[model samples]
Target: MSFSKSFLVGIGTGLLFGSGVTILCIRLQRVAREMDSLSNAIAELATQMSVLAEHLSTLRGFKQRKKRNEFYSASSGDEDEIFEDANLSFISSDSDISKGSKNRSTEDKILDTHVLFNKVEKLFEGDEKNQEEAFRLLSRSAPQHSADCGFHWRMSKACYLVSKIEKSRDNPAKAKDFLQQSVDHASSSLKLDEKCSSAHRWYAISLGSYGEHLGSQEKIKNGFLIKDHIQRSIDLKPNDPFNHHMMGRWAYSVYMLSWMERKLAATLIAAPPEAKIEDALESFLIADRLRPTIWKENLLYIAKCNIELKRLDEVAKWLEAADAVPVQTKDEEEAQKEIDQLLPKYQTS
Candidate 1:
């Protein structure tokens, strides 16, 4: 081989290596830029998460306040001291304030409470006719507040009152109408303060109950929307067990309704092979954990699931628990009776 040829070959090899190194460096720099972008994205997400956590904490504190009657007391001082009593002033005439602007002085707010308390007292302690009159007056008088009353607190209060009235009504259909109105009011309340977590929670629950009511009447798709609203509620406040309970209830209904849908479909097309029964069982189990026996709907679902699974002992236990808790309405009573009739058959087996 000639000397010139060998020298040229070595030079070519060196140039090729340099080119490769330059390309590799460019690739590494591109990768580094991508890493930086990802880091920025992660940082932004972290900030959003922090904000969400703060909001959720505030919501939880509000929900806890309701149990203590914090809203009922005239003193805005020390929330703990205000709600130490289980029952609040809103339940009584003397304690409730008439509709008014929020700019009212503290003294005026207290006076309003005093008047409301008297009215509520007269309503409850008074005759049935007086009670009806009082309810009308109180309903007419409920405040349209100036400031944002957290969505859940305001709506839940309305729901509680409306549900009570519905429970006393002679007609199941009328009771359902009352709950629907509560849901409507709550939905409207959310417009007052969209961030109110409790509003979303109660609204979701009202919708769920409405779905169940519709289901009992053979209204199928209406219940599906209830499930969707509950899912949104969970998204809004992921930590709230109350909303989760509603989700569980919806899931159970969906599973059962799926079967009904399938049966209906079978009449038209070939029935799909039996759906995995385990799917329904898993949904009920999830609901059982989220709410246990906190709501009648929850207990009823768990009992139904146990019955389907042939867990006779669990069914008995659930029925006992249901009875132990106060049944909310005549419909609830009738439902309980039906379940009671089913229990003995399971026990014998």
Candidate 2:
């Protein structure tokens, strides 16, 4: 071959080999980028899977054998659950209220106060018959006229005393009527001075009793107004834990009714889309925080919320906590037991 032809062939062969090497390098770079993108996507998927797994752990202990219909049927007659507290202690004792009078001789004031205190003590400690006897004595002996003392103050004292007696009687009907009377007298006292928190408290209690009455009659439509009365009570006495507890109860009742209704209807029409489950969860959470140990209703709502949100794991956690806490009374215990029995069934269904 000639020298020029040999040089041209050599140069062409070198260029072809160099071009192939460059193309191979470009292919390798593109493959590395694709691999990096896939790795990032896999990491994100793993994080989401971890979150989902944690959520599922909460529901892991829940049994899946029970049916939803069985749970609902068992919970249908939840009437006794409504009256969880019939034995809560009233706020004040007679001794707390009856300090000795200045005008009456010290000896006389002491004597009167002791006797009244003893009567009240007996009223609270006694059964139905003894309570009635104490009530009669209080009606007869309570100073008919604290004339030199303020009339409004005396009226409040009288009303408060009667309320204690009636509450101690333990007869719902009589207790309610007496509470209404107390409310009227308290209102009269407040009309004389509108800023009296005591009067407002008394009125709120009366309103609560009225709400209970409506509930007892199955007037759920009317009973919806209980929230207003309870809210007013909270506003009037923000310092009192009792009123706050009542407010919690009020909110719980609303949340429960919403839940029950939602379950029956298959969806929430009253609550917004995001709010359907979230609203119930929010209310129950507030109630749970405000009064943790005593709020079985709060826990119940939380369980149901977790169920609706499909966070079975959370439901199990809350149910465990609920199961550990004593239910406070026989009725509460029974109700909780029923709920416990229903949990697995409902979850499976």
Candidate 3:
């Protein structure tokens, strides 16, 4: 009887210990999940703070520029004062004062356009809501300065940005529409000022983006135009890293065409521009040298291009670099997602 009681007591103790261990493990898993949630929340908060800081810096720059302009006008002449008083005091009905006022108004409009453009540019690193707000503000102000070349160029860029936002939201049709608008604005800017390198660059980008949404035949037909504009942009701004990046993307797109696609392109149009992975790799390398790791997409594209060329070593190198780039925009985050998937596969292989 004593032995039987001792065995029953042992079994009871064992069951209690196992239950305690199971409870402890459940608690540990819950803590881990909560820690992961907190970590993600902190990361998102940091990104938002960074965007806000950049927006504030842009605003500060605009204010400084405005003050400088005001000081310049004040020290230059009393003409502005006369115009100001003309409406209030009416001491002078001089037509010269009226003309001066008109000129000053035009300058004011240009300044406003500049400030707004800077705001939009800075907001590109922000969230979709912020981008939408910037787009609305630009759309409202840009139309007022239709004749301003800088305004037109900035508007083209704004459209392109909005197109990207739309694309991210899975609205391809709207994105293409925005790209078309970008092309129109860029063309207008060039017509107003033929030497505007920004206009040319954006025009090429918008044209390429628009063509990408079209049929293969249409893409072939527009291929030369895209290449010509990209070259023009590079010639106009040789030091611009973005122009080099654009050239690289163009080459990559062309190199991605399959034999069937190339044959169809040839049938549709005469002599579509030749493209090789070597050219793509070279262009991307140039861009990387010029602006080293500032754009994660550039690194991603370089990796992809290297992969296409069967240079797995370079591909792994670029993929590692891309993993190190900070995610600023949603697009960059998406690019990082792709890198996350590709890195493990190629790294292990």
Best by lDDT: 3
User: Which regions of candidate 1 deviate over 4 angstroms?
Assistant: 1-138, 146-180, 205-224, 235-241, 258-297, 320-335
lDDT of 1 at 311: 84
User: How far is 182's C-alpha from truth in model 3 (Å)?
Assistant: 1.9
Q: Global lDDT of each model?
A: 0.50, 0.47, 0.68
Q: Residue 38 of candidate 1: its Cα lDDT?
A: 57
The reply for model 2, stretches above 4 Å from the true place, is 1-202, 208-225, 239-241, 255-291, 294-311, 327-349
Cα lDDT tens digits for candidate 1, 1-349 = 2334444555555567797765665565455556655564565456545644544444344335333121111111111111111211111111222311122354344444434434443343334455456555555556633233332234344444455555676656666766777677667656775655556655666665565565343344445455556666656666554555555555555556565676774564443223233554555456456445544545655677777777888888776666565544444566568667766765544
Cα lDDT for residue 143, model 2? 66
TM-scores of all predicted structures: 0.48, 0.40, 0.67
Ranking by lDDT: 3, 1, 2
lDDT of 2 by residue, 260-330 (tens): 55454334233321224565576566556545544454566577678778788788777666656555433
- The top-ranked prediction according to TM-score is 3
User: What RMSD value applies to candidate 2?
Assistant: 31.4
Model 3, TM vs. native: 0.67
**Residue 125 displacement (Å), model 3:** 3.1
Work out how many backbone clashes candidate 2 has. Answer: 4
Error of 1 at 116 (Å): 7.5
